[model samples]
Target: MPEAHGTDEVSDARPGPIRVVIADDHALYRQGMAIVVELDGAAVVVGQAGNGGEVVDLCARLHPDVVLMDVRMPVVGGIEATSRLHAADPRIRILMLTMSDDESDLFEAIKAGASGYLLKDLPGEEVADAIRRVHDGQAIIPPGMAATLLQEFSRLSQAGSVPEGPEPTTLTDREVEVLRHVARGMVNREVADALGIAENTVKNHVRSILEKLHLHSRVEAAVYAHQQRLVPPDA
Candidate 1:
């Protein structure tokens, strides 16, 4: 793992590498992550911070492409940190990396502007890939978590915490079909294969879906699809 720290080395570095910041309370884990993310040569660890406060500072100075944040920390938690950093700069992609699967944390992370929520148990390679995907503007909710997230949203809606929005009537039937596949955690290529359509067509459908629903990313679209019950309840 690269022992290099300091935003100076990373801040002025050219834009080729997907600059990353690994924020975890554990020193060992931060070192491990620095190694794993750079293994593929697609990303480089620009900085490491042990707490949320430091993360915010590093992000301000380094301006990384993605931040791997832990939920639990001494001074500030990941959710609050993500909220602050995201509010400051909406473009910085924050991916929550934690051991907790608590629905509350997951929902809160999403609410705080996280691009993705990933369990720490995921393989390092998967984690690296997730960072890249998030940087590329894709949302990375694990398959198991997706259903639970929908359930959480349903409960919140039932409690009237989430204001009801008008149904998205603008989406065509095929777009709706594509949405269901995406909500079920299928990528664009996967959705295209399942629907027997071209990948570019699926991309167009996704773009249209996001635009029609006024959604930002596929993660939000998936959540919207579930909240509207666009797919079978049993699904």
Candidate 2:
């Protein structure tokens, strides 16, 4: 069961709200989640998919900013779909929003290029917040798995298997610090507070980090941070 601590209503002042695609094997669950996800008008469900294949096709035709994917489905699975979608368009953020809490599923999803993994039983508001957060370019790993992810990242870093991207030296010291916080899953506001800077300043630094690193979102930046050994890959 899911919880809802806060009211669902929210204000989205952006010219266009976050575009989302919900892919799940269960129709009823999808229907219910769709309501919660769009309750505040912060996100719009541009498409609903019964499986990973449908999502891939939908994405090919209708681009969405975030994808709420299920781990297990017929014809294709979320992990494989994530890989295909990422290969097709690295800009789309794939989040494994499933019922599975298995460590393998969690690790595999990230390996497949998913920005985050979340259980369906989280609060409704939390779910909504996640859609917005990932859309804003921040990673969202489950709390239980953060430490383990860091360990694996460290192991991979030591093994020299992390993917190659812009070197950390390409970014200034502050941008690198901001990237470090982002890899640790800190939002702009949180990062600002930590660094004793304004939120807008943090946002600027983040934008610069993306541009300099040739990355699309904070999720990718988190991967970069780990590739450069910045963070455990975070909160």
Q: Number of the top candidate by TM-score?
A: 1
The TM-score obtained by model 2 is: 0.77
lDDT of residue 25 for candidate 2: 93
Q: Candidate 2, residues 1-235: lDDT per residue as tens digits?
A: 3321111111222358888899999999999989998998999999999999999999999888889999888899889999999899877888787665545677667778787877888888889987786776566766666656666755676688766687788899998888888777677788899999998888788878878877655655776787775765333
Query: Tell me, what's the RMSD of every candidate?
Result: 6.6, 5.0
lDDT tens per residue, model 1, 53-81? 99999999998888999988889999999
TM-score of each: 0.81, 0.77
lDDT of 2 at 35: 95
Q: What is the lDDT of candidate 2?
A: 0.76
What does the lDDT read for residue 139 in candidate 1? Answer: 72
